[model samples]
Target: MPLRRLLAPLGAGLLLLSAACGGGGEDGDRPEPRRPESSDPAEGAAELMADMSLEEKVGQLLVPVVQGTTAEENADLIEDHHPGGFIYFPDNLSDVEQITGLSNGLQDLATGSGAGVPLFLGVDQEQGMVSRLPVGTRFPDAMAVGATRDPEAAASLAGTTAEELTALGLNLDYAPVADVNVNPDNPVIGIRSFGSDPALVGEMMTAEARAFEEGGVVPVAKHFPGHGDTDVDSHTGLPTIDKPREEWERVDLPPFEQAVDADIDAIMTAHVFMPELDDSGEPSTLSENVITGILRGELGYDGVVSTDALNMEGVRQTHDDGEIAVRAVLAGADQLLMPPDVEAAHSAVTAAVEEGRISEERLEESVLRVLELKLERGLYDAEPADAAAASDVLGGEEHAAAARDVADASVTLLRNEGGVLPLEEGSAVRVIGSGSEEIGAALRDKGYALADSASAADTVVVGTDGARGDAEQKGLVADARASGTPVVVVAQGNPYDIAELPDLDGYLATYSSVDVSREAAARVLAGEVDPSGRLPVDIPGTDLEFGDGLSY
Candidate 1:
């Protein structure tokens, strides 16, 4: 047979197979089929996953940061890699309209690609220091929530947070920090944690998780196994958790167990290394003993496991970009979160599969689970949210009202002496400290006259830095002592800073710098709102130990 004749029948057979596969050619060549819109998104996802090649399957594991604000960047990521999800940062959110539009654009890109699964869009809205939606329903830190000792309040706040996040087309919240802040010097977990007690942390964790679930948002309990005891920040370097397994079982693992029991949708692994548990001295992101043995086998948590940001210095310093993704997958993580190099991650996983380091069955297990999550969240087949509706619901009047209520309820008043509080109306009051300006402005809004210097005032108000009282704080105390004015010191950081300035006439620890803390301070000073918030953690200076609260 001639060469042309021999090729003709082979080409015809190829066309028939393409037709059967629902792939048709562009300009007479076979193009991929569009993702089918189905009522049963899970079945649709399973069917689509079955058709994916090794490259596409591996691509599903890469959750890259989509750079730039345009749909073009998102479309490029989707068309090229077919990523399983998107993680939004503050930069990614300009407003409700912008975020909704961005999410719609990304979903359109995902659907246009051959993959049929809806992209899981996630954000870090844990409240206080790490909220992406700053303008949206700004609540007090987790510590403040814990101070209320009202799990119902925590759950209601979390539900309100979820309602706002979900209205903007975001389905996943990387929140409800479960770390028990045992070390007051802990650089990161400070006010972000519920409290130092594992049981209290567990109660708050369970409530927050339930609230998120009820609001139709997947809540992820994070920094797994705990990041509370370390002094170092993982963002700057790897923090080691050098404790015995028994200590971990008692102290660090309770909140996670509680969260898992509460049916939290996901668990995010911390990068801290616990040598006593893993022995390999590697961060949790790369250790099978930590992710597989402890989180899965020991704790018995069967939810989707995600890694902390792979771009962080802790994980990146130890493993190359490719190895980080591969190790996390092999370590039983269902998602490779925020890899510094997405292409390298894809290549690494593909090579690992070929080299038999990671089995196809393992890849399917993770990808299928991820797909199932997307389906369960109703991400697939749900229409893009209305722009007006998103604007109304996201950080709107209702959210602000809820935030104010939580702030009012969670504010703790730690002290009142000599009845110096309920600042005499029209009395000159000096507000001191970096946060004083903001706090003063809030007070002014309530018709209080606040002065800047102690010399001109009848009373001095100070913001204490929760850690140790530094030289600057000592200087402020000296000024307060010399002024002969009634001094009211409000420790905004942690109540622990109060030990440094015991000479003040009136001392109080609000335990947070958020609006709630400020409001609580103002109310206590004015004697309007009785300080019901007890000390969740002990004030360091007094003979009174941890968990002591005094009546005002």
Candidate 2:
């Protein structure tokens, strides 16, 4: 397997290109590291690749999650393994300065100040439900954006979020979930998707992708080929999408196609299996027909492709870490994300390339895509982000205002039976459920008196985290309704919470349980703002349609 001159068209104003090199020694150890003089990404990547070891080049194809909050905890791993990047989870981070210092420290160990290849420190800051950073502007979920029916709102927040992330030394974001999310009981992607409509989801994804790129963060439009219609969570078990090719195109693939049209730098593959697309029994993450045949050949996408976390049960159900790594590369993914065992995954890939099971061209193709995106984002020349500057940007007042706007706009008035809303800011109210005290305090701040009991209140405001199935929560709603007061339910989680409890006098769907969303629910109830958010998804057991919503 020999390194050859190769070039291919990819998005981001960058070409997937690498030049033949004579720099590495015959024994395959690297020479002294150096920076590229050329500003062009292709030339710069090639110049840097010229000094890489076969070990290093293989390492470039992997992005594993590190083990701790401080850089020293994972110091030996970074110094020894040479992973192209590392993913940040909540356990691996504590604050802005901590994460920033961790990234900067790790890079200093890996790259030695402009002497070696830099690291792609990344996170999954999708804002709602999946936000990894402990402190930041907690923007509402994609479904909240979907409720507003405006792609510009999605773009604006994404750009702002990108700036904040970059300020904290992160470069890649696995976000703006492109899944359609048509399943009402979808355990994984319920509020993550924009809406059920393919075109709208496509538009939102394209808008957010552009914003992330413009903000100097690589937004990887994800769960490719779509994971929207399933009822299972891939983190726990293997899920399968049984749609045929036509239905698959009609439902799941549109957003990804739109992502490609927007020239998204990367797309992540789903762990779920699609038999119609490929009946090989392999999940899409390990299927060549799905990745190479469908995504590359049929869709004409040339950017980087990454597998979802390989440590999950979805990808791990049938294979070990080593086999999963080898199969992912053969499946056309450029990055193997978070395999259970990084060393085994790395060693297996090396062995495969050495055994000629995976050709050098295939391996180099991934390496170039990884390098091309990193170089295109100016990561090669940029310094580690200023940790002290993070406080100024993360959870800024402006970002909070923007997030509030979306949250307020996404408050869907799912029901107003007997005109219970506009509950009069002075009404005596009793709020109960998860985050109930916050909702009660919000009303109290708005001049509404807090009632000690539902029986003494003018309106009983009940908050729920998908209480449609929770018996205790349902009993609370029932007791409130039994009190003969107008029981107004604020569904702070799933919109369908009101479907089973039809006796409730009013209902509001905020689409998220984040602080912004909780505050927005109060505003809508107090009539400080009108309910503008439409339904992104329908309440399956009731009459709520895809676009159903109301105002005061």
Candidate 3:
């Protein structure tokens, strides 16, 4: 039979799959059996990919987000667009059971759609503020983890995390942020990055990728070639990377190269524009010069290329829904990450094919890659995991214990002047600062009481959550100094607030106020863990001296 004639029935089957499964390709025709003992998963995947229609293949390239309390809302979106996958957010999760149910429900929809391939479930479970699994252990932020500078530790943490995700039937974890935090004032990448050094970041990311894959999950190394330097948040607006292509090749591309070398399953494109890298006047997500020309063509990354969320203003502001989808495809992105309109994306690609803009071959190439990834991950024959099993996997005791261990190891005592730390047990300690509740609790657990005022205490712990630096922080610091109590100023978020309290007896920068961070701070205050974590970024001060904390 002619190739065109063979594709006709496949096209009809895809339509039926879309209509029956509600858009997720869940209701497509059953996958054909391979030779029993066919040893190669890729061979099976290629065979399956050959059987899909253009529409079904396109459906395999989309991953969408559905936000509602229940699976009903989630299923509606899955059925409507038949996205190749779904990314879970905090809202989609409540507890382990809820998350399991959510995953199972999605799988059920996929099975019903007749699409033999399993849907890829992805989440940004980076341990701190970005964690989506509620019941999962909340580890320290990436910066804190970086403090340890131990790839073994990072891998161990990721390995535990991956096990939990797999239990819930989620195959993909978008994490191990490879962005080097060179800019201290970086609004979005702050603390999310492992550290400011490219070598360290690359090492940690490589370790994390290996750990995740070893634990039976697909790890996505993301925000390539790097989103570390931009002060602007891509979620709200477009951020440009103004460095020359040579500079990027020297600095930013190293971590991505390391990740590729490690055989990471996916590389997510950044939303930032690097005109120096690509003068196409498009963000990296939509620029073929960046994605294909630089990343794929130059860097030799043949794995799946996923775009950062298409809904973000960085990408959406410049291109409409359909145009963004089409441009990303043209740019060599294998997957459209969270495209706003699934139907429009599908239609746009179809239109592009009809108009001879995107050749059918290109579409097939991307689809085959997607199918290969699914098969490589064992999603083909895998059944919807038991809800009970999922509950056991998410935030299980083992995972949480690992998180606490990493968090405890990350706390650094940046500066402890005049021997103010290791506060005497049973001492009268005055906790006088906003968002010091966690620190205070840690202090009290060590047999310290909150003094009525700074004057009545043997010591005062002035902690800031790094939320604001208005009159409030300054006033508290001043009052503590006036009370004659030995004050320990701890900036729990950014250390910038410490400069205001120049009169403090001691200073510490925890860099974050998350649970693990608080625990590390407590340990450091008690002189338990040596403050080995250097300042990943410079803390500004006239007399503080630049590069004061850099190890090298």
Candidate 4:
């Protein structure tokens, strides 16, 4: 097959502008990897595909988001659009029983639909601010896990997360964020990435991917090509990475490469624009040059290639929901995730196939990948997840213990000036900041005396997670330190928040405000657990460097 470029105007010149954006020929001619001799998922997928109608096949290309807290509430969308999969958000969740029932009911609907296929239920359970379901044991985010600097621990954490997700009837988890946080001011990727070092991020992502596989759930290593260097959040607007190709490969591509090599189930494309790959200013989620030319042609990722949620303003700003779904399919994305208008997107794809715009062969390729993922999770032969057993597996003693271990391993004691840490028992400590009430309560649970004011305290402990700007917190820290009382700055958000504060008597970063992370930080400050977390990303322009952590 000759290299060919289509100038057919796919979502604002996504097809026309890039010469390298060639939609590859059929898979029959391509050098695909061999499937295992045993009746592998690919074989099962092939058999299933043979029996699917054109509408059923086109439906497999879409994975839409549905509103509602229960399966019955969401069943109409599934029954009407016939989406191959569903993505859940916190708004759609209530509790373990509700979500578990929702997943089971969705699968039942999908399985009994036009093609009788099981739905691939997925959620962004990245374990920190992005966690959707509230039933699982919450661990610290990716950066905190990276601070542990132990790939084995990272793997264990992901494995435990996978178990809880599977028990809830979810077969897919979008996690172990592969973006390397190279920019300190990066609006979205901070603390979500493993670190600034590409190699370390790569290693940690691989470990997490392997662990997810071990736990019988498909893991999606996401925001591919990368979202780390940009300061704009894609949820609001498109972010552009203006660096050269070499710099992108150096900083953003390694973890995704490693993930592909590790046979990750999926690599989700970011909504950011990489002009180095495609100058059309289209988000990578709709750019064939980035998805096919780079991810497929260069990296050789044969697994499912999913788009980041199509509803995000990054991609949505330029294209309507229907157009976004069509262009993403043309760009070689195997899954269209969370289109804003599911009905419009589904109808558009069905029409594109019927009008000879998107080739049936092309539709088949993506459907095969989608079905293979479902078959890999054993959805065909398996029964709906045991919702009754969700209580036994989620947040159980073992899961809690594992969370505590990871949390304890990830506490970074950034500054301990004048040996002020390990405060004596019953020391009068004043706690303040966002979530300060919870942090203070955790301290009280550990037998620390709470002080009413900075002037009356032996020490003032300020807990913040950058949820609000740090200037106010910084002023409070400065005033507390000026009063001649010792001040302990507990960074409950990004550790880099320390750079904005005055030098203090003690500094600690928990990298998250999750219950487990907060408890671990409390124990560390109370002289119980050791502070062992190392820095993943450096505090820009500060003396701090990656791998910097102090212990008691």
What are the per-model numbers of colliding residue pairs?
7, 0, 14, 1
lDDT of 2 by residue, 272-380 (tens): 9889988988899999999999899988899999899998998888888899999999999999999789889989999999999999889988888888788899876
Across residues 1-552, which tens digit of lDDT does each residue of candidate 1 receive? 334334533443443343333222122342223443554756766776776778778877777775655445565566567788888887766776667666665655555454534677788888866788744677878887888788987887799888877777678888889998888778888888888889999999889988998888888898887999999999989999889889988988999989877767889999898888787867888888988898888778777888999999888776789988999999889888898888889889999999999998888888877776776676654656456776677637777777666666655655557777767766777888746877677667666778767787878887666537388877877778788888878777766676667666777666667775676677666666666666666544476445555554
User: Against the correct fold, how does model 2 do in TM-score?
Assistant: 0.92
lDDT of 4 at 139: 84
Better of 1 and 3 by lDDT: 1
What residue pairs are clashing in model 1?
24-30, 24-31, 25-29, 25-30, 422-525, 422-526, 466-494
Q: Which consecutive 10 residues in model 2 have the weakest lDDT in total?
A: 11-20
As a whole number from 0 to 100, the lDDT of residue 348 in candidate 4 is: 92
- Tens digits of per-residue lDDT, candidate 4, 21-66, equal 2111222221121223447788878887876678778788778775
Higher-lDDT candidate of 1 and 2:
2
Q: Candidate 3: global Cα-lDDT?
A: 0.73
Better of 2 and 3 by TM-score: 2
For model 4, the stretches where C-alpha displacement exceeds 4 angstroms are: 1-38
Return the lDDT, model 3, position 290.
83
For all predicted structures, in order, the TM-scores are 0.89, 0.92, 0.88, 0.91
Stretch of 10 with least lDDT, candidate 4: 15-24
Candidate 4 or 3, higher TM-score: 4
Worst 10 residues of 1 by lDDT: 23-32
Which one wins on lDDT?
Answer: 2
Error of 2 at 198 (Å): 1.2
Model 3, 82-139: lDDT tens digits are: 5688898877777665666566556655544424356889999887767887776677
